[model samples]
Target: MKRIFIILSLILVSAAAVSLNSCKARDKNVIRIGLNAPITGDIPKVGEGAKFAAQLWLEDIKKAGGIEVGGKKYPVELIIEDNETKAESAVKASTKLITQDDVMIIIGPFASKQAVPAGGVANNYKTPMVAPWSTNPDTTKNRPYVFRACFLDPFQGPVVANFIKDEFKFKKAAVLFDVASDYPKGLAEFFKLAWEKNNGPGSVVAYESFTTNDKDFSSQLTKIIKSGAQILFVPQYYNEVALIVKQAKELGWKGTIAGSDSWGSAETVKLCGSDCFGKFFSTHYAAAGAKGDTKEFIERYNKKYGYVPDDVSALTWDSLNITKKAIESTGGLTGDIKKDRTAVRDALAKIKKFKGITGEMTYTDSGDPQKCAVIVKINNKGEFEFYKSVCP
Candidate 1:
């Protein structure tokens, strides 16, 4: 009887110890990552690319046995929510990420207009958000917790406009922009201002606007063709830009065409086909001629995803890496997140020269990166060729 009692007591103690160990394991081994993107909407490709890159980063981190934080290594767990390419959906997604999931940091919703509303949520919750490719200057302005890895439209717009003026020497230009897209509208305005400022008066001959869902651009193309402009600037995304270029060609309006970083995608070639040849655009980075860390990223991404990554994907990876580095610098989970976030924000702001897959980055007080833009011109082979790099 004494022996049986002793065995029972030992078994009870063992079970209690096992339960405690399980609780500890759960608490110490998990870190949540949140992604708010338009996974099922008109701009699904952009969102899909951002989510894919974030997942790739998480996989790589886990493969290396997770990140060490607060004396414990924790594997990353991603929580992705679709924003449906709407501003209201973005706000809802961000609120869920902060309130329910309790994510330490959040990635993006891909579009500038979406970023504007979503960023407000991050600011309200005091959570850090690293945007992948939202380029509107207003996206990060006055939002303490919001940051981006891509060049803003203000910077990119002037750069491309100047390129058209100086390199192509196109004196008179026409502009066709999407009124619904903050990116295209903002960039179009900047480009027009810069063109007029550089070329003196009457530099902009035709300025036209189209809605996002508009398919036929023959009317706008006809006006641009009759304007006697040497160059045409289409500040819009790949889908609309491709359509416009194709329609312009169909209208027999042949001139130097220019675009913004939104043109940096393989779909541009697929959509415009031969019409995109000889067109030039300013972008953040390109996979071709990539070396060092960029080369490694390309190789790993291709091996993992079975295709080449675009500039948005590359920037998404860089945003994660930047966040990881910032968190690591704060000594993992040891410091208070609010305090650590400030430190991380400061660290990011003070980054003078850091090589990223997107290019060299150095953030200013406004949280904008001082970096070079890559100029790409489409060749007759329907592939983008490196033209030159413009430093600001």
Candidate 2:
């Protein structure tokens, strides 16, 4: 009886050891990255763009036989969590990705509203996170572990303000933005400051505001038209762009309508139609006449998705590649999630220059890129065409 009991105990111990070894092997063989996106709420298109871009990147990774790090290749797995376009959900997603999913890095919650809060969670957990489309300064401000793939609103705001002043020689401007949203509200303020600085105080004739989900802008339009503003700047998402532009025109406003990077989505023209044509906006890239890698990416994405991929998609692609470069630059992972996260974060901070499909980026310790912004015009055919380049 003692011999039988001894044999059973040995068998159980060996089985336990095998299971433990298998778990360790699994962890070492695959790299997990988290994607926190608004897949279902106000901006599903943004999430779709992000997801499609990541998938295309994964296909390239597979073709290369996985990502090579320290002379060895490891497969990558993306754990996508929908933030539902809410700040609370974004925080929850970040927490889950870091604590439960054990993701080595995180990407997205692209909007500043979500990215800002999610960034705090990722920073607290010491995980590296990159926001590809967020332009708000707070998204990466003082967060060592958080970085962004796009320029900050402080830069973008002035770019647009100066563009309007130079292009149209306009002295008076009007601003209409979503007061409840972080990206628009923050960007609107920056633009207002820049405009006023150049044209003196009170140059922004009609600084109007609206909350999110407020479709009717007739009251704001009436005020703007009466304000004698030369141009109206609406720093809003694609969905709201169409409504604002169409409504402004319907109200007999003759002034030009301009926008910010939020107008980079393909849906902007699709939804706005003729109302958006001949309008200019500041964006990350221009797809109508792109060359080299940018052209190739646009072609591939359009062929697969049946529409030109927007700046969001292009930025997301670049961000994923940047993440991959950071991972490989680490030489190898130590199989410890915490140690690996720190290594990747350090590697990312050290990347001096990265040529992305959108543009070239030079990183500093602040985690924001020093790059130029593109001024894009919606041509007669509803295509986003490159108008001018503004550098800081």
Candidate 3:
């Protein structure tokens, strides 16, 4: 009887041990990441690129058996929400990610205007958000939980303006911007200020604004052509910028066209065809002939997705990697959600001189990266070719 009782106790002990092990495995082997972006709409290509790159990263992590968090490996699962290029939709999607999906970290809503509202939702839930390409300062301004891997518009605008003045040696310029986008409008104003500061007053011959959905830019292009401006600056996204360039070419506007990072996309060349050739723009990174980590990412991305990565892809990859670094540095999400989020936020705020596939990312007090900007010009082949780098 005594021997039988001892054997029964051992069986119970073994069962309890197995149950505890299973619970630990479950706790240590899964991480949920939220991806919120405009996957459909006028500028769906950009969001698609970002989503594709992020999915590729997660796939790679899975193939490698996932990431090591707090001495345990966990597979990453990406939960995607399409914002449809609407701010209200972005907010709703973000709320779903926060409340329904319960993602601790979010990446997304590529446009600055969309990011503004989506970021607000993350802030309300104390979830850390890393924006891949929203350059408007207000996206991260006064939002401690919000962080961006890309440089703010103020920094990039001046960089492009200075490059135009010093590198291209342009004195008289014209401005064409999207009035509806905070990214373009804010960047245009900053570029104008930088142009005047570098050159003399009244250097910009013409300043024009257009709505985001406007396709026919013949009127604005005609005005710019008549202004006798040597260079034209269009601070807008790839879709509209491509259309504007095509229309501008049709209008016989031969001035050099310049724009912000929003012009970085594969569809830009496809949409504008030969019209976009030789147009210059400021961007974060490029995949063609990229070296070091950039080259590695390009190779892996091509192998994984069967296509070359773009600026948006590189930025999204960097954003996710940065978030992983922050979480790893914080020793994993084991504490209270609020406290863990604060720790991750603090870790991200202290990121300095971290080399990323895009460039070296150094976070400021506002959680914007102070990094190098690349000047890329569309070659005659309609491909973005590297020109020069500007460090900030």
Best by TM-score: 2
Error of 1 at 318 (Å): 0.5
Across 236-304, the per-residue lDDT of candidate 2 in tens digits comes to 999999999999999999988899999998888889899999898999999988999999999999899
Higher-ranked by lDDT: 1 or 3 = 3
Give candidate 2's total backbone clashes: 0
Clashing pairs in 1: none
Tell me how far candidate 2 lies from the true structure as C-alpha RMSD in angstroms: 2.8
TM-score of each: 0.89, 0.94, 0.90
- Per model, how many backbone clashes are there? 0, 0, 0
Residue-wise C-alpha lDDT for candidate 1, range 75-167, written one tens digit per residue: 778899999999999999999987777677888867887988898888788888888889898888998788888888878878988887779
How many pairs in model 3 have backbone atoms within 3 A of each other, for residues 3 or more apart or on separate chains, i.e. clashes? 0
lDDT of 3 by residue, 1-392 (tens): 99999999999999999998676443324677899988998689878888888887887788878777688776778899999988999899999887776676899878888998888888878888999999988888889989998888888878888888887798899999988878889999999888888888999889999887888888888998999998999988777887888788888887788988988888788877888888889999865568998988888877877777789899999999998888788777674555766787888888777889998888866668888899998899777888889887
Stretches of model 1 off by over 4 angstroms after superposition? 1-29, 334-347
